[model samples]
Target: MEQLANVKAYLCAVFGAVVGGIVNLMGGWSEDLTTLLLFMGVDFILGLLIAALWKKSNKSDTGALSSYSAWRGLCRKGVSLLVILIAYRLDVTLGVEYIRSAVIFAFIANEGISILENLGIMGVKYPTALKKALDILTSKAENSESVK
Candidate 1:
Protein backbone atom coordinates (compact mmCIF):
# COMPACT_ATOMS: atom_id res chain seq x y z
CA MET A 1 0.00 0.00 0.00
CA GLU A 2 2.83 2.42 0.77
CA GLN A 3 4.46 1.66 -2.57
CA LEU A 4 1.18 2.17 -4.40
CA ALA A 5 0.66 5.46 -2.61
CA ASN A 6 4.12 6.64 -3.59
CA VAL A 7 3.51 5.76 -7.22
CA LYS A 8 0.21 7.61 -7.22
CA ALA A 9 1.84 10.65 -5.72
CA TYR A 10 4.57 10.61 -8.29
CA LEU A 11 2.07 10.31 -11.14
CA CYS A 12 -0.03 13.14 -9.76
CA ALA A 13 3.00 15.40 -9.48
CA VAL A 14 3.96 14.68 -13.05
CA PHE A 15 0.44 15.39 -14.25
CA GLY A 16 0.31 18.65 -12.35
CA ALA A 17 3.60 19.81 -13.76
CA VAL A 18 2.51 19.04 -17.29
CA VAL A 19 -0.76 20.87 -16.86
CA GLY A 20 0.96 23.85 -15.26
CA GLY A 21 3.41 24.06 -18.14
CA ILE A 22 0.59 24.05 -20.65
CA VAL A 23 -1.30 26.70 -18.72
CA ASN A 24 1.78 28.89 -18.69
CA LEU A 25 2.11 28.49 -22.42
CA MET A 26 -1.53 29.52 -22.80
CA GLY A 27 -0.96 32.97 -21.21
CA GLY A 28 -1.32 31.65 -17.68
CA TRP A 29 -4.64 31.88 -15.80
CA SER A 30 -6.83 34.98 -15.51
CA GLU A 31 -10.39 35.79 -14.52
CA ASP A 32 -11.48 35.77 -18.14
CA LEU A 33 -9.93 32.38 -18.80
CA THR A 34 -11.43 30.99 -15.61
CA THR A 35 -14.89 32.27 -16.56
CA LEU A 36 -14.55 30.86 -20.04
CA LEU A 37 -13.57 27.45 -18.64
CA LEU A 38 -16.48 27.52 -16.21
CA PHE A 39 -18.91 28.37 -18.97
CA MET A 40 -17.50 25.67 -21.19
CA GLY A 41 -17.83 23.06 -18.46
CA VAL A 42 -21.37 24.08 -17.65
CA ASP A 43 -22.33 24.09 -21.30
CA PHE A 44 -20.91 20.62 -21.80
CA ILE A 45 -22.67 19.22 -18.74
CA LEU A 46 -25.96 20.83 -19.70
CA GLY A 47 -25.71 19.41 -23.19
CA LEU A 48 -25.11 15.94 -21.80
CA LEU A 49 -28.04 16.25 -19.43
CA ILE A 50 -30.30 17.51 -22.17
CA ALA A 51 -29.43 14.52 -24.29
CA ALA A 52 -29.36 11.89 -21.57
CA LEU A 53 -32.14 12.96 -19.23
CA TRP A 54 -34.48 14.98 -21.45
CA LYS A 55 -33.75 13.37 -24.82
CA LYS A 56 -33.92 16.85 -26.33
CA SER A 57 -30.47 17.29 -27.82
CA ASN A 58 -30.69 18.65 -31.33
CA LYS A 59 -27.24 17.30 -32.15
CA SER A 60 -28.71 13.91 -32.80
CA ASP A 61 -31.50 12.80 -35.12
CA THR A 62 -33.04 10.77 -32.28
CA GLY A 63 -32.59 13.66 -29.85
CA ALA A 64 -30.72 11.38 -27.50
CA LEU A 65 -27.18 10.86 -26.27
CA SER A 66 -24.75 10.22 -29.09
CA SER A 67 -21.12 9.29 -28.66
CA TYR A 68 -20.26 10.83 -31.98
CA SER A 69 -21.88 14.11 -31.12
CA ALA A 70 -20.24 14.17 -27.72
CA TRP A 71 -16.86 13.46 -29.23
CA ARG A 72 -17.36 16.19 -31.80
CA GLY A 73 -18.29 18.66 -29.10
CA LEU A 74 -15.18 17.81 -27.14
CA CYS A 75 -13.10 18.21 -30.27
CA ARG A 76 -14.61 21.61 -30.89
CA LYS A 77 -13.75 22.69 -27.38
CA GLY A 78 -10.20 21.52 -27.87
CA VAL A 79 -9.98 23.50 -31.09
CA SER A 80 -11.32 26.56 -29.34
CA LEU A 81 -8.58 26.29 -26.78
CA LEU A 82 -6.08 25.95 -29.57
CA VAL A 83 -7.42 29.14 -31.08
CA ILE A 84 -7.00 30.87 -27.74
CA LEU A 85 -3.43 29.61 -27.62
CA ILE A 86 -2.87 31.10 -31.05
CA ALA A 87 -4.34 34.37 -29.88
CA TYR A 88 -2.01 34.37 -26.92
CA ARG A 89 0.99 33.86 -29.19
CA LEU A 90 -0.22 36.68 -31.39
CA ASP A 91 -0.44 39.00 -28.41
CA VAL A 92 3.06 38.02 -27.41
CA THR A 93 4.37 38.63 -30.88
CA LEU A 94 2.60 41.96 -31.24
CA GLY A 95 3.51 43.11 -27.70
CA VAL A 96 -0.16 43.62 -26.83
CA GLU A 97 -2.47 42.07 -24.23
CA TYR A 98 -6.02 42.09 -25.57
CA ILE A 99 -5.88 39.31 -28.09
CA ARG A 100 -6.16 36.40 -25.68
CA SER A 101 -8.77 38.14 -23.55
CA ALA A 102 -10.88 38.95 -26.59
CA VAL A 103 -10.78 35.35 -27.78
CA ILE A 104 -11.64 34.06 -24.32
CA PHE A 105 -14.54 36.47 -23.90
CA ALA A 106 -15.90 35.47 -27.28
CA PHE A 107 -15.76 31.82 -26.34
CA ILE A 108 -17.41 32.63 -23.03
CA ALA A 109 -20.31 34.27 -24.80
CA ASN A 110 -20.67 31.34 -27.15
CA GLU A 111 -20.66 28.90 -24.25
CA GLY A 112 -23.19 31.00 -22.35
CA ILE A 113 -25.51 30.94 -25.33
CA SER A 114 -25.08 27.20 -25.63
CA ILE A 115 -25.87 26.73 -21.96
CA LEU A 116 -29.00 28.83 -22.30
CA GLU A 117 -30.08 26.88 -25.35
CA ASN A 118 -29.61 23.61 -23.48
CA LEU A 119 -31.69 24.97 -20.62
CA GLY A 120 -34.38 26.02 -23.07
CA ILE A 121 -34.44 22.51 -24.49
CA MET A 122 -34.97 21.25 -20.97
CA GLY A 123 -38.00 23.56 -20.60
CA VAL A 124 -36.19 26.00 -18.36
CA LYS A 125 -37.69 29.36 -19.11
CA TYR A 126 -35.55 32.46 -19.12
CA PRO A 127 -36.13 36.13 -19.87
CA THR A 128 -36.14 37.24 -23.46
CA ALA A 129 -33.95 40.16 -22.53
CA LEU A 130 -31.21 37.84 -21.31
CA LYS A 131 -31.36 35.94 -24.58
CA LYS A 132 -31.19 39.12 -26.57
CA ALA A 133 -28.15 40.29 -24.63
CA LEU A 134 -26.35 37.05 -25.33
CA ASP A 135 -27.26 37.30 -29.00
CA ILE A 136 -25.81 40.79 -29.10
CA LEU A 137 -22.65 39.70 -27.37
CA THR A 138 -22.24 36.81 -29.79
CA SER A 139 -22.68 39.12 -32.75
CA LYS A 140 -20.16 41.56 -31.37
CA ALA A 141 -17.71 38.77 -30.73
CA GLU A 142 -18.13 37.59 -34.31
CA ASN A 143 -17.59 41.07 -35.60
CA SER A 144 -14.40 41.43 -33.61
CA GLU A 145 -13.13 38.13 -34.94
CA SER A 146 -13.83 39.26 -38.48
CA VAL A 147 -11.96 42.48 -37.92
CA LYS A 148 -8.76 40.57 -37.27
Candidate 2:
Protein backbone atom coordinates (compact mmCIF):
# COMPACT_ATOMS: atom_id res chain seq x y z
CA MET A 1 0.00 0.00 0.00
CA GLU A 2 2.88 2.36 0.75
CA GLN A 3 4.39 1.64 -2.63
CA LEU A 4 1.07 2.27 -4.34
CA ALA A 5 0.67 5.54 -2.46
CA ASN A 6 4.14 6.66 -3.52
CA VAL A 7 3.36 5.93 -7.15
CA LYS A 8 0.10 7.87 -6.84
CA ALA A 9 1.93 10.83 -5.39
CA TYR A 10 4.46 10.77 -8.17
CA LEU A 11 1.71 10.66 -10.81
CA CYS A 12 -0.13 13.53 -9.20
CA ALA A 13 3.00 15.66 -9.20
CA VAL A 14 3.65 14.90 -12.84
CA PHE A 15 0.05 15.76 -13.74
CA GLY A 16 0.24 19.04 -11.90
CA ALA A 17 3.47 19.98 -13.68
CA VAL A 18 2.02 19.15 -17.08
CA VAL A 19 -1.12 21.19 -16.37
CA GLY A 20 0.96 24.10 -15.16
CA GLY A 21 3.08 24.02 -18.28
CA ILE A 22 0.05 23.99 -20.52
CA VAL A 23 -1.51 26.86 -18.60
CA ASN A 24 1.63 28.89 -19.05
CA LEU A 25 1.74 28.09 -22.72
CA MET A 26 -1.87 29.17 -23.07
CA GLY A 27 -1.06 32.79 -22.18
CA GLY A 28 -0.62 32.64 -18.39
CA TRP A 29 -4.23 31.78 -17.52
CA SER A 30 -6.01 34.88 -16.25
CA GLU A 31 -9.24 34.83 -14.21
CA ASP A 32 -11.31 35.88 -17.23
CA LEU A 33 -9.88 33.05 -19.26
CA THR A 34 -10.47 30.52 -16.50
CA THR A 35 -14.04 31.72 -16.09
CA LEU A 36 -14.53 31.39 -19.83
CA LEU A 37 -13.29 27.80 -19.66
CA LEU A 38 -15.69 27.08 -16.81
CA PHE A 39 -18.49 28.53 -18.89
CA MET A 40 -17.52 26.26 -21.77
CA GLY A 41 -17.66 23.24 -19.50
CA VAL A 42 -21.09 24.21 -18.19
CA ASP A 43 -22.28 24.84 -21.73
CA PHE A 44 -21.15 21.39 -22.85
CA ILE A 45 -22.84 19.71 -19.93
CA LEU A 46 -26.06 21.62 -20.59
CA GLY A 47 -25.87 20.64 -24.24
CA LEU A 48 -25.68 16.98 -23.29
CA LEU A 49 -28.57 17.39 -20.91
CA ILE A 50 -30.66 19.08 -23.59
CA ALA A 51 -29.92 16.27 -26.02
CA ALA A 52 -30.91 13.64 -23.48
CA LEU A 53 -34.10 15.49 -22.67
CA TRP A 54 -35.03 15.77 -26.32
CA LYS A 55 -34.44 12.05 -26.81
CA LYS A 56 -36.60 11.23 -23.80
CA SER A 57 -39.41 13.42 -25.13
CA ASN A 58 -39.19 11.75 -28.57
CA LYS A 59 -39.43 15.14 -30.17
CA SER A 60 -36.40 15.15 -32.40
CA ASP A 61 -35.03 12.90 -35.11
CA THR A 62 -31.54 12.98 -33.67
CA GLY A 63 -31.11 14.09 -30.12
CA ALA A 64 -28.40 11.78 -28.86
CA LEU A 65 -24.97 12.91 -27.93
CA SER A 66 -22.32 11.35 -30.14
CA SER A 67 -18.60 11.10 -29.63
CA TYR A 68 -18.11 13.17 -32.77
CA SER A 69 -20.10 16.07 -31.30
CA ALA A 70 -18.18 15.86 -28.06
CA TRP A 71 -14.88 15.90 -29.92
CA ARG A 72 -16.01 18.84 -32.05
CA GLY A 73 -17.00 20.79 -28.96
CA LEU A 74 -13.62 20.10 -27.40
CA CYS A 75 -11.89 21.20 -30.58
CA ARG A 76 -13.93 24.39 -30.63
CA LYS A 77 -12.90 25.21 -27.07
CA GLY A 78 -9.28 24.43 -27.90
CA VAL A 79 -9.46 26.76 -30.89
CA SER A 80 -10.92 29.48 -28.67
CA LEU A 81 -7.96 29.15 -26.33
CA LEU A 82 -5.57 29.16 -29.29
CA VAL A 83 -7.13 32.38 -30.55
CA ILE A 84 -6.72 33.96 -27.12
CA LEU A 85 -3.10 32.86 -27.03
CA ILE A 86 -2.51 34.39 -30.44
CA ALA A 87 -4.13 37.59 -29.30
CA TYR A 88 -1.95 37.63 -26.18
CA ARG A 89 1.16 37.16 -28.28
CA LEU A 90 0.13 39.93 -30.61
CA ASP A 91 -0.41 42.23 -27.67
CA VAL A 92 2.96 41.29 -26.20
CA THR A 93 4.77 41.83 -29.46
CA LEU A 94 3.13 45.18 -30.02
CA GLY A 95 3.76 46.31 -26.42
CA VAL A 96 0.02 46.65 -25.69
CA GLU A 97 -2.24 44.46 -23.51
CA TYR A 98 -5.58 45.33 -25.07
CA ILE A 99 -5.90 42.59 -27.64
CA ARG A 100 -5.99 39.70 -25.18
CA SER A 101 -8.77 41.26 -23.12
CA ALA A 102 -10.77 42.00 -26.24
CA VAL A 103 -10.40 38.44 -27.48
CA ILE A 104 -11.33 37.01 -24.10
CA PHE A 105 -14.37 39.26 -23.79
CA ALA A 106 -15.59 38.21 -27.21
CA PHE A 107 -15.29 34.55 -26.26
CA ILE A 108 -17.05 35.17 -22.97
CA ALA A 109 -19.93 36.74 -24.84
CA ASN A 110 -20.10 33.83 -27.25
CA GLU A 111 -19.98 31.26 -24.50
CA GLY A 112 -22.56 33.17 -22.47
CA ILE A 113 -24.92 33.14 -25.41
CA SER A 114 -24.38 29.42 -25.90
CA ILE A 115 -25.11 28.71 -22.26
CA LEU A 116 -28.29 30.76 -22.47
CA GLU A 117 -29.37 28.93 -25.60
CA ASN A 118 -28.80 25.59 -23.95
CA LEU A 119 -30.88 26.70 -20.99
CA GLY A 120 -33.59 27.92 -23.31
CA ILE A 121 -33.62 24.53 -24.99
CA MET A 122 -34.07 22.98 -21.57
CA GLY A 123 -37.26 25.06 -21.23
CA VAL A 124 -35.93 27.97 -19.26
CA LYS A 125 -37.35 31.33 -20.24
CA TYR A 126 -35.03 34.27 -20.67
CA PRO A 127 -35.58 37.95 -21.33
CA THR A 128 -35.80 39.48 -24.78
CA ALA A 129 -32.50 41.25 -24.12
CA LEU A 130 -30.78 37.90 -23.95
CA LYS A 131 -32.10 36.96 -27.36
CA LYS A 132 -31.12 40.34 -28.78
CA ALA A 133 -27.61 40.00 -27.39
CA LEU A 134 -27.29 36.52 -28.82
CA ASP A 135 -28.45 37.79 -32.18
CA ILE A 136 -25.84 40.54 -32.08
CA LEU A 137 -23.16 38.03 -31.27
CA THR A 138 -24.36 35.73 -34.02
CA SER A 139 -24.22 38.51 -36.55
CA LYS A 140 -20.79 39.54 -35.40
CA ALA A 141 -19.57 35.97 -35.72
CA GLU A 142 -21.06 35.69 -39.20
CA ASN A 143 -19.52 38.97 -40.26
CA SER A 144 -16.13 37.90 -39.01
CA GLU A 145 -16.42 34.56 -40.77
CA SER A 146 -17.33 36.32 -43.99
CA VAL A 147 -14.34 38.59 -43.62
CA LYS A 148 -12.10 35.57 -43.29
Candidate 3:
Protein backbone atom coordinates (compact mmCIF):
# COMPACT_ATOMS: atom_id res chain seq x y z
CA MET A 1 0.00 0.00 0.00
CA GLU A 2 2.79 2.40 0.86
CA GLN A 3 4.50 1.54 -2.40
CA LEU A 4 1.32 2.25 -4.29
CA ALA A 5 1.02 5.62 -2.62
CA ASN A 6 4.62 6.40 -3.52
CA VAL A 7 4.00 5.40 -7.13
CA LYS A 8 0.94 7.60 -7.33
CA ALA A 9 2.89 10.50 -5.94
CA TYR A 10 5.65 9.92 -8.44
CA LEU A 11 3.20 9.83 -11.32
CA CYS A 12 1.64 13.05 -10.13
CA ALA A 13 5.04 14.68 -10.02
CA VAL A 14 5.81 13.60 -13.57
CA PHE A 15 2.46 14.79 -14.79
CA GLY A 16 2.86 18.12 -13.02
CA ALA A 17 6.34 18.52 -14.44
CA VAL A 18 5.04 17.93 -17.95
CA VAL A 19 2.25 20.43 -17.41
CA GLY A 20 4.65 22.88 -15.86
CA GLY A 21 6.79 22.61 -18.95
CA ILE A 22 3.81 23.37 -21.13
CA VAL A 23 2.91 26.36 -19.00
CA ASN A 24 6.48 27.54 -19.25
CA LEU A 25 6.39 27.19 -23.00
CA MET A 26 3.30 29.35 -22.96
CA GLY A 27 5.20 31.85 -20.75
CA GLY A 28 3.27 31.00 -17.64
CA TRP A 29 5.00 30.36 -14.37
CA SER A 30 5.74 26.85 -13.22
CA GLU A 31 3.25 26.88 -10.37
CA ASP A 32 3.61 24.78 -7.27
CA LEU A 33 3.29 21.09 -8.01
CA THR A 34 0.63 20.62 -5.34
CA THR A 35 -1.57 23.22 -7.05
CA LEU A 36 -1.15 21.64 -10.46
CA LEU A 37 -2.03 18.19 -9.17
CA LEU A 38 -5.10 19.53 -7.45
CA PHE A 39 -6.28 21.27 -10.59
CA MET A 40 -5.71 18.16 -12.69
CA GLY A 41 -7.54 15.98 -10.22
CA VAL A 42 -10.48 18.33 -9.98
CA ASP A 43 -10.63 18.81 -13.69
CA PHE A 44 -10.54 15.05 -14.23
CA ILE A 45 -13.31 14.35 -11.71
CA LEU A 46 -15.39 17.15 -13.16
CA GLY A 47 -14.90 15.70 -16.60
CA LEU A 48 -15.90 12.28 -15.36
CA LEU A 49 -19.03 13.65 -13.77
CA ILE A 50 -19.85 15.48 -16.96
CA ALA A 51 -19.49 12.29 -18.94
CA ALA A 52 -21.62 10.33 -16.51
CA LEU A 53 -24.38 12.87 -16.34
CA TRP A 54 -24.43 13.40 -20.08
CA LYS A 55 -23.58 9.87 -20.96
CA LYS A 56 -25.15 8.56 -24.13
CA SER A 57 -28.05 6.23 -23.76
CA ASN A 58 -26.21 3.60 -25.71
CA LYS A 59 -23.12 3.07 -27.82
CA SER A 60 -25.05 4.10 -30.91
CA ASP A 61 -26.12 7.57 -29.82
CA THR A 62 -23.29 9.90 -30.86
CA GLY A 63 -24.62 13.45 -30.77
CA ALA A 64 -23.89 16.19 -28.31
CA LEU A 65 -25.24 15.89 -24.81
CA SER A 66 -29.03 16.02 -25.14
CA SER A 67 -29.66 16.92 -21.54
CA TYR A 68 -29.11 20.19 -19.72
CA SER A 69 -27.14 18.27 -17.11
CA ALA A 70 -24.46 17.65 -19.66
CA TRP A 71 -24.46 21.23 -20.77
CA ARG A 72 -23.98 22.39 -17.22
CA GLY A 73 -20.91 20.22 -16.87
CA LEU A 74 -19.44 21.58 -20.06
CA CYS A 75 -20.17 25.10 -18.97
CA ARG A 76 -18.41 24.65 -15.65
CA LYS A 77 -15.14 23.59 -17.20
CA GLY A 78 -15.44 26.12 -19.97
CA VAL A 79 -15.95 28.99 -17.59
CA SER A 80 -13.15 27.94 -15.27
CA LEU A 81 -10.53 27.63 -18.00
CA LEU A 82 -11.78 30.69 -19.79
CA VAL A 83 -11.29 32.70 -16.65
CA ILE A 84 -7.79 31.35 -16.24
CA LEU A 85 -6.82 32.07 -19.83
CA ILE A 86 -8.29 35.51 -19.79
CA ALA A 87 -6.36 36.33 -16.67
CA TYR A 88 -3.17 35.04 -18.15
CA ARG A 89 -3.70 36.93 -21.35
CA LEU A 90 -4.34 40.12 -19.45
CA ASP A 91 -1.13 39.56 -17.58
CA VAL A 92 0.79 39.32 -20.82
CA THR A 93 -0.85 42.33 -22.45
CA LEU A 94 -0.53 44.66 -19.48
CA GLY A 95 3.04 43.66 -18.64
CA VAL A 96 2.24 42.42 -15.15
CA GLU A 97 2.14 38.89 -13.81
CA TYR A 98 -0.68 39.51 -11.36
CA ILE A 99 -3.37 37.91 -13.46
CA ARG A 100 -1.45 34.71 -13.94
CA SER A 101 -0.69 34.55 -10.27
CA ALA A 102 -4.34 35.22 -9.53
CA VAL A 103 -5.46 32.42 -11.75
CA ILE A 104 -3.04 30.04 -10.12
CA PHE A 105 -4.06 31.17 -6.66
CA ALA A 106 -7.73 30.79 -7.48
CA PHE A 107 -7.21 27.28 -8.78
CA ILE A 108 -5.15 26.39 -5.76
CA ALA A 109 -7.88 27.65 -3.47
CA ASN A 110 -10.51 25.75 -5.38
CA GLU A 111 -8.47 22.57 -5.23
CA GLY A 112 -7.83 23.11 -1.55
CA ILE A 113 -11.54 23.50 -0.93
CA SER A 114 -12.22 20.29 -2.80
CA ILE A 115 -9.52 18.57 -0.79
CA LEU A 116 -11.17 19.62 2.44
CA GLU A 117 -14.53 18.42 1.21
CA ASN A 118 -13.08 15.09 0.17
CA LEU A 119 -11.35 14.63 3.49
CA GLY A 120 -14.56 15.38 5.31
CA ILE A 121 -16.44 12.87 3.20
CA MET A 122 -13.87 10.31 4.22
CA GLY A 123 -14.47 11.23 7.88
CA VAL A 124 -11.15 13.04 8.20
CA LYS A 125 -10.50 16.39 9.78
CA TYR A 126 -8.59 19.27 8.22
CA PRO A 127 -6.96 22.29 9.74
CA THR A 128 -8.99 25.46 9.66
CA ALA A 129 -5.91 27.67 9.21
CA LEU A 130 -5.14 26.08 5.88
CA LYS A 131 -8.61 26.71 4.58
CA LYS A 132 -8.48 30.25 5.87
CA ALA A 133 -5.21 30.91 4.10
CA LEU A 134 -6.60 29.50 0.87
CA ASP A 135 -9.68 31.68 1.22
CA ILE A 136 -7.51 34.77 1.56
CA LEU A 137 -5.49 33.83 -1.50
CA THR A 138 -8.60 33.20 -3.56
CA SER A 139 -10.12 36.48 -2.54
CA LYS A 140 -6.96 38.28 -3.49
CA ALA A 141 -6.88 36.53 -6.84
CA GLU A 142 -10.46 37.40 -7.65
CA ASN A 143 -9.41 41.05 -7.53
CA SER A 144 -6.09 40.56 -9.23
CA GLU A 145 -6.95 42.57 -12.27
CA SER A 146 -7.82 45.54 -10.13
CA VAL A 147 -4.44 45.46 -8.46
CA LYS A 148 -2.56 45.74 -11.72
RMSD for all candidates, in order, please.
Answer: 2.1, 4.6, 9.4
TM-score of 1: 0.88
Q: Across residues 1-148, which tens digit of lDDT does each residue of candidate 2 receive?
A: 9999999999999999988887786678788788788988998788777766554222234767666776778899889888987887888888976677667767877888888867766788889897787677556655544553
Backbone clash count for every predicted candidate, in the order shown: 0, 0, 0
List model 1 lDDT by residue over 18-131, tens digit each. 989888989998887888889888899999999999998889999999999999999999899999999999999999877787788789888988888788888899898988
Q: What's each prediction's TM-score?
A: 0.88, 0.77, 0.52
Best by TM-score: 1
Order of the predicted models by TM-score, top scorer first: 1, 2, 3
Instruction: Name model 3 segments beyond 4 Å from true.
Output: 1-21, 42-83
Q: What does candidate 3's lDDT look like per residue over 12-117, in tens digits?
A: 9999998776665445655543465556566446444434554422211452234565456457645665566676777789888666676767777777776566
User: Which ranking of candidates, highest lDDT first?
Assistant: 1, 2, 3
Candidate that scores best on lDDT: 1
Stretches > 4 Å off in candidate 1: 127-148
